[model samples]
Target: MGLKYKYESTSRRDTKELARNVRPGDRLYVIHDVSQVVAPLEDAQLYSEFIVTKDKAPFTGTPMVCSASAHRQVGGTSVTSLLVRYGEVYTERPVGIRNIAEEPPLLPEFQHLAARVAREHAADVAVARSEAASSGRRRWF
Candidate 1:
């Protein structure tokens, strides 16, 4: 199956309600893809050339200095770009690209927190679930 991008919009009211309802151990899953929103072009280019051409770009040699300068030029700083530019070269082969997976598993810590929160706010879950279901969200899952 092809990758389907899912977009969710939450109002401030809804977010506040959720936050208020949340318990200490409640599991929170914050799903995001920085690369999808912002391309780390400089980093990508730097790595591609370094790996394929077997030569270090000036930026690759002194990543901190290069990143500071790049950020000034680009008008934004990106950690992904910095890592790609300055990170140690990996010996492992890159995995082949595939369709983005839906419902990727939450981290163990998050899962535990979620379970605890869900249990504590069972009533809230029903309410939230009902609201979510009724809100007519465009589902990609």
Candidate 2:
């Protein structure tokens, strides 16, 4: 079965097309009215003093928007930044693909979102596995 797409409006279709056309190397600056904090992944053993500057060297990465708002490869590790909601982008400290499976910041406000992100990831995995299994022929004895 195929998922039904609502192309009822031209604007929606155009936006979809635009997203489809984004390349991996395209630069998308994740800017906000003020600077934002970036979270480091586990084992980075780095300090948490890093922040995405609003003036220079802003948070930037390849257009791999999904689990993370942007992604960049640093020091051979996969660093992914989660940009959820406005100005809430999580980076892997200095560089590297930040593993989203890791927890968010320890702030009381963001603690609640950690569980939700985990659940969403789990659901995505389950759905993908089911889809793959459903595509195969069933065997009955």
Model 2 misplacement above 4 A: 1-105, 137-141
CA-only RMSD, every prediction:
22.7, 19.2
Runs in model 1 with CA error above 4 Å? Answer: 1-98, 124-141
TM-score of 1: 0.21
Candidate 1 per-residue lDDT, tens place, 1-73, comes to 2111211123334323332332322222222233633654212222111111112234523111121212232
C-alpha TM-score for every candidate: 0.21, 0.25
Give the alpha-carbon lDDT of every model: 0.32, 0.36
Worst 10 residues of 1 by lDDT: 45-54
In the range 2-119, model 2's lDDT, one tens digit per residue, is: 1122211235443343234434333322222322334233343322222222221134432344322325322221113222222222222335433334454576766789879989
